[model samples]
Target: MSTSTSTSTVSEEYVSTASRPSDLRITDVRVANLHGVPFRSSIIRIDTNQGLVGYGEVRDQASASYALVLKSRIVGENPCNLDKVFRKIKQFGHHGRQGGGVSGIEMALMDLAGKAYGVPAYALVGGKFRDTVRCYADTPSLLDPHEMGERLLERKRRGFTMLKMDVGISLLWDVPGALIAPAGSRDDVSTMHPFTGIQVTPKGVEHLASYVDTVRSIVGYDVALAADHFGHIAIDSCIRIGRALEPFTLAWIEDLIPWQYTDQWRQLTEAVAVPTCTGEDIYLTENFKPLLDAGAIRVVHPDPATSGGIAETKRLGDYAQEKGIAMALHLAASPIATMACVHLAAATENFLALEHHAADVPFWSDLVTGLPRPLIQDGYITVPDTPGLGFGEINEELFRQQLDPRDPVFFAETTHWDGEFSHDRLWS
Candidate 1:
């Protein structure tokens, strides 16, 4: 059953949390940087005059500048005016990491609106399908079968029921006759998938299959397992590898082919018994339509940080639900972004699981307050009824301690990005 509720029919005044007509306005847009071991990611804070604030994070490795640049256009607008506010800044967001800013801004706005209205973010979108969102452990791929098995088994021990691993030709470099270098390009994955000539030989396929077999032997058949980052090989190799691993019943072969090549995706889906998944690099629903329409892949992976935030992600899920396609979220961000995924996952009926890429970072759960201490338990995030995103605030001392030595901890007044430099008019 779908817990999704259409609150649009409910008047804003009726949902107000402050007991008044809900006249809160955006006051400040602040940015902060947090580290994931060596990698640095950005988070945003959208404050309102009513003392309610919303927090969000940009896509991993993207700049806080992406979110800060939009402050001028967003400040002073009513955070509750989502449709209008999103459209106003939607023009500023483009594909890939550039979309992070607009998406982050939208997330912050949802939190603000949810807080002012005293509701969870999911309630603002639709209701929810589950109180808890399932998480898949995104454990790093280890080349050594013994080590990989141990690593995956540790994830199982840690309580992640579902798991994904990095597997591909990159890990097979030492094996004999595994990959053929392209005609002109270096061994780097610079060449496109099909043209890369990075053929995965039969020996290569068996080696990779054996590795997954080792993982399956340790974790057993009950838990769902997925494979990702298999190098930039083409469709033929993808099918060969997928077919070889068919007996393992791998959950899905992710990004086996690049996301844009729909025909290839369709071919991979048709060729293999295992499922296929993609769409993290994709920006909005428009880009995903062709993939869905073609029935290209069995699963649609939309990273909330990259896929236009909470509402747009639900739109993706709703679209997938109609087409009978499952949706899995790609998350490699902070708990703030992960919680956004949790709220959206609760609301989306088609949701499968949300990726918990930061499980290895001990301080990962410590980054945010007010949410649960563990953030994830037994591979699931229990939804909180607390108003807004339910994350109280960023742990300033811990955040500063984890800051990228190259950047400052929080917003240092992005006045340079405060104003629009050029007119942005699409219509004549």
Candidate 2:
């Protein structure tokens, strides 16, 4: 018998030996914890026997244990079978931060598959629609209206053409007679949006609109300015505020009321000239179907880390586009999650712009090494051609400098998160 085999006529025995479990078995799962603005962030790495690793992130403030527990179910399986792995794990996920675990795991799997096949993450989905992803920056609220105007001007100076800001009623807190509520209870938050009875006085309305007026005066009409964080006011107040700002021409007023109030969003959307947007905390596509079907809002904002990873978010965007709704991603995590959004935005045609929440952090872009230097420039991130989320390695030294001092651990041992706690099957 000859030991040598021809390249075209390779033996089945040789093929069997070269393929299967040995070449791509899962080896380990590790996590690095860092502080993303407003909360903490956990970055997970899925390492295989072949030395390739996939990276993902649990939504900021979500416990990394949500993803680590699934390690037992997938330790020895092929990381390349993303859909199979996702289906097996999707049952365990729910809405909000609960979805973070499953979505993060899905992101890691996509990263893995992208690397194994030598393609960009978006290529694994539906391929690229654009090479650069536009980004929007969030400006913090300032007590002084003039200072806020100056602050917004600085962002424009930095070349960001699109911006969002907090326009909550909290601004009118100190203004006597501006708001009327229960003696001590907060009127802005009652059983629901309509019942809140949180009306803005004629003066208060002017005060709130003045914030937008100042920003518009400085940044002018060239920028796409949006508003959010209205301090949980009623739909009526949201409409009142929205109506007052109609002249400013905002891109959208985000999350005017809770997303669950689909009818409220519809009413506000119909009543106001400004566009309405929501759904950053949503988890599944089906959950978003009703809102789109009702023509509830003009835009859908999904944070990939909280939504059902890439496929679900893309599905949401596709469905939104079908109904003429644009998708503007909501992201506030580290580079791990940012790249995931980049790939998703690349593959999605209706994507408007992804959010960049760490502009003030200074070291935010310094935490990762694989993507282009200055991850964002002039409000746009040029998509990287490299495989697996396009990041080379975690810049640990830089990351450590910004790690949350209260809980600093870089890929710490999580052996206890290794086992399943309960049977996850939902239906009998």
Candidate 3:
């Protein structure tokens, strides 16, 4: 794909050229499900006669229908006219996770275009600012203090100086009971259904504190400890939990309150000495401006897939930097998005750390081959200087092993509804 720009008083011309006489046709778009994972994602490949191909992933799980519908609109478009194609398709798709299809397709096209032009994806987004991207190890949920200590040590051994742990499971210590209790009731509130479940009980809080104490003792004060995945609890409950975990000197308490509660986040951030962070589920950079402007969070957490892919994520980080707020990326799922995050992190100056969920997956690092640099070393990831995402090929053997036999990841081609749904009037 080639890029060209021509300016005129009456009009402006910007066109991208495919290497061959024929345009780059989206030959195939496939969706694959990783075994034992929560959701299925769509991966699009745009192929050209020049033997150039581009790849992109749509963040859709349980919502594969949206991706299938998008394939129809993109199959015949020239992959080189990415912006034009993205705008055109986005007009028809504007609600829910369906936006992921358009966004994912855009990412793939950009990757392809960069390869076609012999440049890195970061180069396509202007240029790069750094080479090595800092990564943080996300510690899994642990029920026992010993288990938690072991996880922390493992992360240290992996060369990760920053670690995040689950501190909100105290509400689940009771079985056959609700996850969170009512505002002031000590009695079992399990009967309250989803409304009054318990997220942190007195006993559960003590257990969490003991666990944090254990982790602190093991990792010591040198490494950074962060906490997240606190089940939904009241603002007061979050403040209490934040204060309780203070001895660990956590880097931040993530998503303490739901992301939409800006004022509550402000209160929580102010109530405790620990820094507060959120924003993984938030949409575009525009959505993040409010939280950053209000100082509701000290650090901005954006998952590139959820926040409009690489370009938009970098824009969000640049905006956060302008506000003097640090940025930490939240990533989960396949290496497609993780590699994209690495490129974006490498280009942004305010980057703090990138999440590596597949760090434990033995073949996860090998899923993509021909990486410009080793995937990890001493807890740091070296960014690839190669064109596009710098991935040589997909490890079919590993992907096959991890494929969910029941679901079997494959793209389901189908047309979307052309008209508004009947339920649209109900909300109005």
Candidate 4:
């Protein structure tokens, strides 16, 4: 497919030299590190021989090295042939933060593909299911339940119809008789849920339940509410906490245990009244199959940065729909990743709501240009009809202001990663 852009204003045009997708060849890969936009993040830029640059971001808290290391593999390929390039590099990815490289590249490729075909990213996958994507506010935890409720009410005042909050053992640390942890197990965060031997007492359950009750009383039943980050507690405690909070009618309880324990997830799902949701740390669509096949979860939450970017995330959502499960996305990165999720959620039929982690960051929307101000309004983001992931360009001034102090590089040259040292093929 051949495409052309007019020599218009910077916000209305993409600077490019080549007009045909067939002639596009990747020339270089670079990264910009940003910290304290809320979380540490790395944004990637892939330059092509055609002057068409595609943008993406690594998973929040993941190293930029994850993407920089793959520069050698994709330096000379066509960005529009996504699956062909994905297959060649996906072997380098695994679950959790390790998957960031492949997924980010996939997003960049999708962006280039859309621009090459003169369509939005959603069109390349299929057509969109909705014109605007609904977003849920992700709030941090506070020490006081009433204070947290008031804080959530503030989000509701801003027009969020859905919300998620942290309700974990972090709250019970001070209350005497609230927990039963053996010696050396009091502040354990590394032990697996099954081996932790940390149990929430009856008082602990009541204490946690009261927090949700306060929030529910303030927010009312007019909006959907979800809870997460319940600490590394065992399944029995997960079930207990899930049952106690059932009275408030939570939308779902997330990550009570790790996502890999499908059998344990099934047991918790069957035992609780609230819907069980997971898959944020999961890498690809195939790994989600065991959870869907066993009826272990009611909702699947995949961060595009960790779940394999726009196309793979769409595939995962489609497969979950076939199994009668709903899909919600977990996102906590820059505007590039947010727009990617917006396109993915727009195209997926069973999509629930996209998480907006930067709702409170004043400069978050300023990171990109050519989009509406207050990018989210009345709890929804209007999907862009523009080509690619649908933003004009990175707001260089604002981006520079948020650069990570440790490595304040803005799309610097990456010639060191240009030479491939070993063969990358999986089979002869």
Candidate 5:
């Protein structure tokens, strides 16, 4: 296969691979919503007549409208003109959460371009730093310590050496008199629009500590253990919970408070010995800079779907390297975003691990075909050696099984409010 390189006028240093000098055209763009899973995601499929198809996804729920609007901007552009296409779409997309649409489309284009050239997506980003990407399992939230231990053992049996659990829920039998607040007390949390309920109580916290202790005891000290979704509690409550679980030595405490609270994150990192990680909801590298520059946390986590797809996520990871920070991708969606992350992790040197949320979903791995190797073995995913993402085939059967009932799979018309706006600025 012949390859060509193009440099952006804005930054001569920014160069990317182009497919055959003239064969680069986006033939088709389609979106699919994979529902009923932990999170919803809109997957974008871009096809080219050159017999190459690329896949990318914009995070679900938060900004589906933005991603849909981006389809118009990308429909006729040359897939190989990555720099030009990204620049053009970005100008129309603005920044912050609204950027997801443009970013998702950009990811699909790159995936298509890579397949056209017969190189993994990472190679286009400047080549691979690692052949195998480390994976962390998101364990289920169980009510019993014994049951939680059983779940950990199951994950361990499947070869996962790193695991994360939802530690904020207290409704299980493990905690007694743990929930103190009335259902309406956390109305503020309710209004946030994404997550609701207050399950982690004082007794619940103690039970959770015991649960972590049990998990750590069974898994031993060699494995990595992490926690997240600590409920909508005050900073002091976070501190207390952090202190209680200190003995287990968690890998990091994730999203203990809202991600917007930079000062609170810094304080939490300072107060706890465990490493701190956040930024799944944050949009791009620019949004991540403040936390990295402030030394707010030892690790930076970004979900490619929400943070702007592969290229942007790679930029964020590269920047984090400059600050001596590690990058761990937070992903929970369809195979489109999961495979996109694999490419990014392969290219990034400072990358630590990537979350495989669908590890337990029987058909999740089947959603895409032609992966160069098994998605996971002994808790590690071998990067695809084939061109593009090496995604084999979309398992329509599996997709059907996972579709969200509330909103069936269909391409809705792009709402008018979706894309870049003159008044929009990323950070206020």
Candidate 6:
């Protein structure tokens, strides 16, 4: 019982009391709302009793309440038990931004589990298929096709091998005889594609194809070009536009119609030579089944922040792979979410590319530390093998500078949320 003998008996391999994984408990969950770090986004911090912390981001433009409401459900649970906590809280989630809360928390859990066990997040998801994840830069639509081509060329000049641009019916709204839609319905975003009775006239189809022609001519065939935001056009319009751009060999046409329209997706996929893609709003793996089962699309684009975070998106990618469909991530949030996507893309075999939506945001890489200076290199993110999401620290100073004015609090005490309760059970 002598102190000297007791000290000598301790093994070198013994874990320190401070790092005990089993004893780890969720102490609190807080939010930092940031605005125009490009766009509004909420970053979630899950604190533990052991002084360890993990970070995640709500989908871009999503409200912070999406995460705060779930704080009470996880206050005392183990962060490492990801699936258990996920199952307990997932019922509260739904498709689109509503899923941000459960998805962000899942990411935080993956971070904590990785840090606790001392492995990269990808390792926790069965390891990686690649070291570097190729990124595709998103170039917004410009009225002038040549100007848009020049913008895409700038992306190429920055070393991006893949690029995407907006090609939709909106561009044809003012053009005489370009589009055939109800007089006042063109601007109404609430209208679904099929109900709008929108048709792309031959003139509109030609105009849309001209933009792709201009871009493809400037960027050349070596670059993998993609298009998105088809503006809720009907199936016939989508097919017409798709066929018109087939000569350009687009990587894929994204969200051609709503993801819920699997039958329409199949029709669009079959009618057009260009590959059809959707599912950025989809929430879970099973939700992607109908599209996959019917061979509705050639590529499945899921934003990890919306598609159930780390493990679930990986599962979605695995399922897509089995059905011979490729996956490309959709992300427009902070570097925290970007790293999460990089980890998922690395682990998923059929991952085609991870969308880099903030390539133009100068301070995007500055928001996180312990990574390379330029977060993206030559249109690819080198997957970090470091523990968790691979960033050593959050650049708090930068976050403070970019805080959303409406909710200027940064990681403020969330005690009010701790008392919130809901009967979340779906079955007896």
By lDDT, the best candidate is: 4
TM-score of each: 0.93, 0.93, 0.82, 0.95, 0.83, 0.97
lDDT of 1 by residue, 1-428 (tens): 13334455455536645523157888888887767632567888887787777888888888777888788888889988888898888887767788899889888888888887778999989888899999999988877877887888888888899999998887788888776756554456566788777788888988898888887898889889999998878788889998998999888889987888999899889999999999898888988999999999999998888889999989999999899999999988888888888899999998999998877788888887987778889888999888778788878888888777787656556667667455666788
- The Cα RMSD in angstroms, rounded to one decimal, for candidate 3 relative to the true structure is 6.6
What value does the lDDT take at residue 188 in candidate 2? 33
Q: After superposition, which runs of candidate 1 have C-alpha atoms over 4 Å from their true positions?
A: 1-21, 183-187
A best-first ranking of the candidates according to their TM-score comes to 6, 4, 1, 2, 5, 3
- Give lDDT for model 2: 0.83
Q: On residues 1-428, what C-alpha lDDT tens digit does candidate 6 reach at each position?
A: 69877776675337455667788899999999998756888999999999999998888888789899999999999988888999988887789999898898889999998988888999989999999999999978898888989999999989999999999876888889898888778668898888888889999999998878987898899999999998977888888888999999999999978999999999989998998899889999999999999999999998888899999999999999999999999988888999999999999999999888887899999999999989998888899989899999999899999998888888999888878976767779
Better of 1 and 3 by TM-score: 1
lDDT: the better of candidates 4 and 5: 4
lDDT at 352 for candidate 2? Answer: 92
Window of ten residues with lowest summed lDDT in model 5: 1-10
lDDT of each: 0.84, 0.83, 0.70, 0.91, 0.75, 0.90
- Which portions of model 5 show Cα errors greater than 4 Å? 1-19, 36-39, 49-51, 60-64, 91-99, 169-183, 186-188, 191-205, 372-374, 396-428
Name the top TM-score candidate.
Answer: 6
Q: Give the alpha carbon lDDT tens digit for every residue of 1-428 in model 3.
A: 12333234224324444353235566555565565322455455555556677766666452544445556566667776666666655543332354566556667777877777777888877677888888888868777767787878898887888888887754354534324555554544333212444456565666667778887898888988888877656776677778888877888889866677678778888888888999877767777887888888988997776677777778899999999999999876566766777788888889899877656766656667886334778888787878788788776777666665765654333233222133222234
Q: After superposition, how far is residue 89 of candidate 1 from its true place, in Å?
A: 1.4
- Return the TM-score for candidate 1, rounded to 2 decimals: 0.93
For model 6, the local distance difference test gives 0.90
Q: Write the per-residue lDDT of candidate 5 for residues 1-428, one digit (tens) a residue.
A: 12333334434455454445366676566666777455777767676666567777776554566666565566667887887888766754444456667778878877777776777789899999998999999976776667877788788788888888887743333345776554565445444312444445677677768778877787778788888877676666677788888888889988887777778888888888888888888876888898988898888988787787889889999999999999999887776777788889999999989998876676566677776334678888788887777677776777766666765665434434234345433458
- Tell me the number of clashing residue pairs for each predicted model: 4, 1, 8, 0, 6, 0
Model 4, 1-428: lDDT tens per residue? 12333334553556553558988889899999998766988899998887888998899999888898899988889999998998888888888999998899889988888888789999989989999999999999898989999999999999999999999898998899989888877667688888988899999999999999998999999999999999878999999999999999988999999999999999999999999999999999999999999999999999999989999999999999999999999989888999999999999999999998987799888899999888899999999999999999999998898999898878788898887558766779
